[model samples]
Target: MLSLFLVALASASLLPGGSEVWLARQWCQEPAPLALWAVATAGNTLGSLINVALGRYARHFQGRRWFPASPQGLARGERWYRRFGEWSLLLAWAPVVGDPLTVLAGVFRLAWWRTTLWLLVAKGGRYALVLWLADAWLAPYC
Candidate 1:
């Protein structure tokens, strides 16, 4: 449990790792899907919160080419923010665009509660879907 929690936390942070793969492997080992789900969701959500804070405070560093919000990501995130407004946060758990979206939310200074609510929903859904797919289709094979 501790390992899973740490792994999930690390994966969700600005670091590079895949929490879904970690969660799946741990679920297979311990058979505690719910616990794994909670840990992964909580960790990923917290990480995204950090991204929001970074967006809130790191605007000065945006000139750099490799800031957390890359140039392309900033443009795409801006479009999403402009087009969908706060509702675009529902994709906060997406791969290519999700992490930057969280930062964009903060850059736009969106309401914190709304951001967190949608972020939790998206991240939780992702972790749940991973477990569901594994249980429904992979279990029999394993």
Candidate 2:
């Protein structure tokens, strides 16, 4: 469970990891599905919160030489956030865009409760789907 939690956390952050694969493997092992899903969701949500913190403070350094994003890029991100609003957090489970979306939520100062709610739903739903698929795929062999 700790390993699952860690993997989920890292996967949701800027770090590289694959929690879905870990969860699927754990699905065939001990511990209940509910526990696994909850742990993964919680960990992923916590990881996203890290991104939110980074986004919140990162703006202070936007124009510095060390800052990653250019002025135009930051402006573009702000525009995108304004256009989509906080509701776009529902896609927080997606691969490429999800991490950035979480950061964007922080950048725009979306309500913490709402951001977390969306993250829990999306992350939990993703793990549930993974578990379902794992069960179906492994049924023949078991």
Put down candidate 2 lDDT per residue, 16-125, tens digits, no spaces: 88999898778777537888888988999999988888778878887799988889887887787777867778888898999988888887777788888888888888
Question: How far is each candidate from the true structure, as Cα RMSD in Å?
Answer: 4.2, 2.3
Model 1: per-residue lDDT, tens digit, 79-109? Answer: 7777786877778777777777887788877
Query: Where in model 1 is the C-alpha error above 4 Å?
Result: 60-83
Q: Extract clashing residue pairs from model 2.
A: none
- Report the Cα lDDT for candidate 1: 0.80
Question: lDDT, candidate 2, residue 103?
Answer: 89
Cα lDDT of candidate 2 equals 0.84
Top TM-score prediction, candidate number: 2
Say which candidate scores most in lDDT.
2
